[model samples]
Structures are given as C-alpha cells and as structure tokens.
Target: MQQIILQPQTPDELRLVKQFAKVMKIKATTIKETPKARKKREILDGIERGLAEIKLHQEGKITLKTAQQVLDEL
Candidate 1:
C-alpha cells in the first residue's frame, strides 16, 4: 500500500488532518465491495427515477391531476 505524509505547519492544519484521517478510516472500514455496492446503486437509481417522474409531472409532461391522484393513492 502507498503511504501518505501530512506535514502540517499550523495547529489548525494538524487538527484538520487528524479529523480528516479519522473520517477516512471510518469510511474505508465501512466500504462495501462490488455486489453490495451494486445493490446500493440500484436503490439510489430508483430514488432518482422517482424524483425525475415527479419533476416531469410538475413540468406538465404529466398532468397535475394525475400526479395528485398518484400521491393520494400513495
């Protein structure tokens, strides 16, 4: 693995790097590999699709009455 060195001249820079390292480590530990990441991506894609549908409805590509009816059904 490659190594990184943080040469912080100021106390604030040192503190910032420490906090950044902590968060980076936490994220590295929690990272999921391909299959799990794909599942997460699918879920996010569904959410984006839903948002796009709502936007289209608002923009008049889809009727407001139909949108309201769908929202009511939900």
Candidate 2:
C-alpha cells in the first residue's frame, strides 16, 4: 500500500477530505504538530535557553542589567 499526504487550502476542503477518507477506508493520522507547531517548539526552546541564562544570572555567574540599561549601552 502507498501513502498520500495532503495540504488542503481551506477549512471546507479539510472537512471534505476527512469525510472522503472516512468513506474510502483510508486511515488518517491528523498531525497535531505541524509547521506552525515546529515554530512553536523553536520558540519554547529559546525560552528555555533564556531561562537557563536567567538561572545563571541569579547564581551570580553572570551580571546583567535590565532591558533599559542594555538599551542605554547601545
């Protein structure tokens, strides 16, 4: 058996495609995480890294100022 992937342009098309799949016995695994989801993951990763830096700052391993101070230095 072969597999086919689809990217429907509209909500109506998505609904229709899912209905067609149901009638055709084609098992569908709707992905909860898509390209947008990948982008979200990237954002969360950056947040985690920033939090790690903040933790270091809290331990006095690095000394950083507020946003306004950084901006003033620029």
How much lDDT does each candidate structure score? 0.72, 0.89
Cα TM-score of candidate 1 = 0.40
Candidate with maximal TM-score: 2
- How many pairs of residues in model 1 come into backbone collision? 0
Superposition TM-score, candidate 2 onto the true structure: 0.46
**Residue 7 in model 2: shift from native, Å?**
24
Per-residue error for 7 in candidate 1, Å, reads: 35
Off by over 4 Å in 1: 1-33, 64-74
Clashing pairs in 1: none
lDDT of 1 by residue, 1-74 (tens): 76555456687986787788797783322232489877997899999998998899888897555667889998
TM-score of each: 0.40, 0.46
User: What C-alpha lDDT, on a 0 to 100 scale, does residue 1 get in candidate 1?
Assistant: 71
